[model samples]
Target: MKPSAFEYHRPTTPEEAAELLAEFGDDAKVIAGGQSLMPMLNFRLAVFEHLIDIGRLTDLTGINHDSGSVAIGAITNQATVGRSALIRTSVPLLSRATPLIGHFPIRNRGTLGGSVAHADAAAEYPAVALTLDAEIETLSSAGRRTLPAAEFFIGMWTTALRDDEILTKVTFPIREGRSGFSIAEFSRRKGDFAMAGACVAVKVDNDLRVESCSIGLFGLGSMPIRATSAERSLVGCSIDELQVRDVAHAAVSGLESVPADLHGSAAYRVRVGATMVARALKSALEEATDD
Candidate 1:
């Protein structure tokens, strides 16, 4: 099925695009890369009378890294991210998660903003953002405002972005000291969405004990979930004394609203999610200790 007829609006500037959305209100939608939105539109799952295409805004297309943070322009494609030395060195967790996002061809056209804004339960970028406490920056008539990843994602396929707001960039704070990151997931095929997955970032002390840890789960909940309790449990624990399976279990133990579908029962998803967390946590710990 084709999308319903709609006005095609190509706004050269983000401010102009935000204005279009502000004017069109509920009838308008912002589109960049269009990988996710186009599929929904083709399926008639979402319909809008106006498409505010900010694909060429230029203002949102690069990677910037400072000592403390890494800011990726919203329109930067996943392929660029994968090849980015800055991203790999400064935000290694993001780099590791990049290849896991669909296939190379999809990554070529899928914008970072599109993936995050679309907020798919199984997407890698959102999980990475949540794990890193990244800040999402937006532009609107009200001017600029930054929303932390924790507050940016509200529910499945929804965000805190206002009608007039255009996401311009996402900034991730660097993890200092000895850090390691890993992501683990189970998918039906190489390019298919994960049935369950976890992204782990860990910082260890010189004694090889956990100083801090962040685990972000995807494909098992309504929104990207931060396994905060599990993180707290691992603090100060030596790698040799840590039981990865137990921590993984704790991560999923408190989870509610995990989705159940033909892919798996809610129980099955929980099991898979826990296993992913275990695998990711183990790999991250190994990396941290090696460093």
Candidate 2:
């Protein structure tokens, strides 16, 4: 299916994009890599009178690290981000999760910011962002503001971004001290959306006890599930098989809603989600010990 007729504008600067969005308001949609938006447009899932293309904005296309955090430009492609040595070194959880997002070609055209803005519950970036306590930066004619990942995703395909605002970048805090990260998911196919997934980041003390941990679950609810219960379960304990199982159970214990679809039932998804969380936590623990 072909997209409906619309006015297209290519903005070279974020200011120009902000102005275009402000002028068009809800009638405008921002297009970066076009990986997610193009499909929505083709299928008529989303329609807009003005298509604002910010893919050419050079300012929003690099990865930079400062202190203990890394800021990734919104327009940076997933392929680039997945392969970035800087990201692998600074934010390994993101590096581990990016490859799980579709295939190489899709990653080539998918933008990190686009994924975060799209806020697909089954996608990898949103969960990773929540796990790392990432900050989302947005711009508008009214100026700029930053939001925590938890506040950014309000619901499925919904975000706190206003109609006239554009997400410019995401800043992720790097894990300090001895840390390890892992992501696990269950999907029908290699590039398919995960039926259930988990992202885990763990920081350990010199004695190898779990100091701090972050667990993010996807494909189990309206939005990415931050497994705070599971995180708390492991904070002062040694990361072993028994502890991992306890953490996994805690991760899904309070999920009030589980999506029921042709793919699986709510019970099935919760079970799979728990397993994925256990696997991720175990992997993260192994890596932490190695470090």
Candidate 3:
């Protein structure tokens, strides 16, 4: 099957893209890397009347780091992001998770914004973004605005972005002092969507006390889930294996709402969630201590 016939518009500027979206409304769709969207189009899952391609907009193409945050352009490819030294050093959680996304070829063509905006429940970027409380900046006909990562992911294949809005950048805060990051996932093979996964980020003080912690889960929910209760457990605790395990356990204790798919049952996914959380947190804690 092929996508329904649609008008194609390649916008050179975000303003132009926004205007096109405003004009076409729900009938319009944006194309970035075409990694996820193309498949949906090929299957006739998305029937759009217009495709506004923003792939060439120079504005949406780079990684920038500052004292307080790291900002990545919406069209930045996963391969570029995965290999970025700034992302690795400043937002190590993303670095730990990126390699787990599909494979090298997919990464080269898949954009960070596409993955996060598409909001696949099993994707890596969403977990890192949500866990770090990253800010998603958007341009719309109304104006530019920033959406909190927590508010951005409303459900599977859904987001807070309106039809006229295009995500321009994703920004994650840079932690000071000793920080830890970890990600764990299960797949039938190296490049498959995870059956279950977890990401853990910890910031620690000189006294080995946790300053802040964020844990995000995927492949066990409708959207990337930030484990608030689990994160709270790590605050003020000394970063250690026992503490990490306790928090990991707390992370999945009440998660009885996961979907049952062919990959696994709800009970099995919950179990995987707990185990992955423990592994990720333990590794993150170790990394924090070493730093």
Q: Say which candidate scores most in TM-score.
A: 1
Instruction: Tell me the deviation in Å of residue 59 in model 1.
Output: 0.6
lDDT (0 to 1) per candidate: 0.92, 0.92, 0.88
Write candidate 2's Cα lDDT for 1-291 as tens digits: 989999999987999999999999989999999999999899999999999999989999899998889999999999999989999999999998998999999999999999999999999999999999999999999999999998999998899999999999999998878888999999999999999999999989887788999999999998998988778878778654346776788899879778998989999999999999999988988888894
Cα lDDT for residue 274, candidate 3: 89
What digit string (tens of lDDT, one per residue) describes model 3 on residues 133-166?
9999999999999999999999877899987899
Q: RMSD for each model, in Å, please?
A: 0.9, 1.1, 1.3
- The reply for model 3, stretches above 4 Å from the true place, is none
Candidate numbers sorted by TM-score from highest down: 1, 2, 3
Supply every candidate's count of residue pairs whose N, Cα or C atoms clash at under 3 angstroms: 0, 0, 0
Error of 1 at 157 (Å): 0.6
TM-score of each: 0.98, 0.97, 0.96
